[model samples]
Target: MKEMILMTPGPTMVPEEVKKVAGAQPLHHRTEEFYELFSNLNKNLKEIFKTKNEVITLTSSGTGGMEAVIANLFSTGDKVLVASIGYFGERFYDIAKAYGLDAELQDFGWGNAVDPNVLEDKLRNGNYKALLVTHNETSTGVTNNVKEIAKIADRYGVAVIVDAVSSLGGIPLEMDEWGIDAVITCSQKCLMSPPGLSFVALSERAWKMAETSNLPKYYFNLKKAREGVLKPNPDTPATPAVSTIMAVAKATNMLLEFGLDNVYKRQATYGKRVREYVKSLGLELLPEEDIASDLITAIKVPEKYKASEIINHMKEKHGVLITGGQGPLKGKIIRIGHMGYVTEEMLTKTLEALKDAIKE
Candidate 1:
């Protein structure tokens, strides 16, 4: 069978080194060798998260990391505001509501970024405990101004929790510098690794909130996670995805070796090139150019064409797999993911396939 290139918004293409490590024998989580690997992984994750906090690894998808934040940070009946720009943002609000928190959703429309001014206005009028936001909205390919949003939340004394699942490694997020309280990310996106691992880091303030949080939690208990990591031989409370961790450990070191700045530049370049080429095809973008994501591009499906037809043709005919929109925007847009181990040659091939898919 021919190998298909992944242009969907994650589980992205993995590097050969990462694949090799992942395919190798799994490690015993309790062994000293695994401890060393886990310790180094945590250190590298801190560098990637740009925080001094302990970055806890979980054995679940990115949604687990998001749920952990809600379970550990705030108690039942705590008032929080969810600022949503797209599907994942709504997911955050849904998680909070399920946890029985008094969550209010402030929708900024699907294709737009969260307006910091509008956020400030809401926070000024409400006494909320925390403000949940998504750094990159993958559904509509919009990157919110998290830095500015964090500043506004801080003035209102609301803890800022960010869902950075698809954006963390691809985009620059200064967890400490921006005063963000908590951030959640996953391995299958820009980390250049496989699925099954999600990571979360907390600010000092977030940890303090955890100490007082009365929410019910066991498996997603971050305090237990922290305790396990703080031990002499670091480990997770439960058995982790040992192979996935191995792969991510290798993949992250590769990123550090390449330099984070260069990775950001490369991702930005790919995004710009893809957007430009799509426009050259006389296509429209779902989001405005200024707020477009650097990790993915959401192109509006041209009139008289179905999104599924374009996606299926790209994959079945050309072996290039892109994705359609989610939630309300489904069937209206197609997303091209350019994060994690994507090269100019690969992108060129995918774009050519896309052009042919749309034209023919």
Candidate 2:
């Protein structure tokens, strides 16, 4: 039997150990055993988020975390400055609008990172109650300088909400030290786990925002979630995805055991190797070198070639599944993912397959 390699940005390859947990018999969310698992998961989540604040787990995809941030941290008519560079950053703008918030977007080019100087100017001049940004723009393979942006936002006394969906465990971010108010991530990207769980962490300032936010929400209500989790037993506000939570528990343990710094180093090294190998094939990168993400690499397709040609050929002929570009980039580029359980051997094979596919 041949193995299928996932080279997409997410719903990334899961580890066998984590898969084993997800495949196990389901447990009731109310049980003592489940509480213990949930507790340990939250503890590890705080470490992964690099925050001392309580990390909340929701039984939804990464978007749920982003939505939760908007739902709980700001009221309707309250203004937010969305620093948008790519698809996911645009998503932040969309989310804000969906909630009836006054969202002013600072649009950078799709293939570039957000300029901190530009962000600083906006924060200093705008009357925004919050600054929303994506830590990693998965669509463009660009990573923003959240630490610097947070510093600038902090100086302006604006709350910083970050979408760390694809970068959290694979990249380095310090939520507490950098004064990030809200951070969002998911199980499928860098956690080496299957999809269906999203994590949200809030700083003290963010919690304070939640206290006054009047945005209408139910399942994604962060205040309700905090109330439940802050209890002595600590539980989710809703009936949790028991199996997925168990799987994430195993995955987070594995990441911690590997050491967070070492895990980040591995992902960065793999990302660099992918970039170098793709460039050697005369492929150009979408993002600037300084802003390129350490979890995924977006390569521009040659003028005469279609991204689907290489992507479909690799999947059909070699069982290597990489993804094509999104939104405006569809058919113009291909993205190679190096996060989670992706290995060097798999990347080498993927590169070889891509090379052959391109020649065809």
Candidate 3:
């Protein structure tokens, strides 16, 4: 089979070194060696998150981390606001509602970023305990101003929970400096690893709220997970995705070694180049340039072309796998993911293939 370049949002291309680590024999979860690896990974994760909080690792997808945040931070019937800009934002609202929380969703439209001013307006009169926000909306290629949103939530004494699954390692998110209460991310996206491992870091304020949280939870319980980490040997209560953990440990170390600032700059450069190239080809983008995401770019499909045709043509002809829009935007947009271990040559090839696909 031909090696198809994965330009999708998640499960991005993995480095051979990281793959080697993941392919290694699984380590015993209760062993000293595993504990050391877990301990170091947590420390590295804290640095990546730019927070002093204990970053808990869960053996689940990014959505599981989102659900865990909802389960651990707020209880049933708690009034919470979900400020949505795209699909993931709606997912947050759905999770909140499923947990019996009074989750009020205030959608800011698909191609738009969440207005901090509008969010502030809602918090002032809503008497909400918490607000959920997605840092980067992959489905629409919009990146919200989470720093400003967190500041506004702080003013209203509302806890802020962010879904940074696709943005954390690729974007600049200072969890502590921004006063974000909790942030959820996974290994698959910017971390340049496989799926199955998700992470969540909480502020002191969030931990306090968890102490009295009445939500029903066992596997997604943050406190128990916290206790496991605090143990003398340091571990998770349940067996983790051992190979995935190893892969992420290797990937995070590589990022740290390369420096987080460099990673952010590279991602921004790639995003800018892709957007400019797409526009130069007479194609349109779903979101405005100013609000576009640095991890993914969603382009408007030309009127005469089908989204599926473009996606299929890119793969079948050029061995490049891109994605289409989701929900209401499906069949209307084509998304190209340039995050994690991507290069200038890869981007150039992808753009050339896209142009050919459109022309053909």
- Residue clash pairs of candidate 1: none
Q: Which residue runs does candidate 1 get wrong by more than 4 Å? A: none
Instruction: Kindly list the per-residue Cα lDDT of model 1 for residues 118-148, writing each as its tens digit.
Output: 8889999999999999999999999999999
The number of clashing residue pairs in each candidate reads: 0, 0, 0
Please write out the lDDT profile of model 2 over residues 315-345, one tens digit for every residue: 9999989998988999898998888888778
Off by over 4 Å in 3: none
In the predicted model 3, the residue pairs found to clash are: none
- In candidate 1, residue 67 scores what lDDT? 97
**Model 3 whole-model lDDT (C-alpha atoms):** 0.94
TM-score of 3: 0.99
Q: Each candidate: what lDDT?
A: 0.94, 0.89, 0.94
lDDT of 3 by residue, 272-299 (tens): 9999999999999999989999899999
Better of 2 and 3 by TM-score: 3
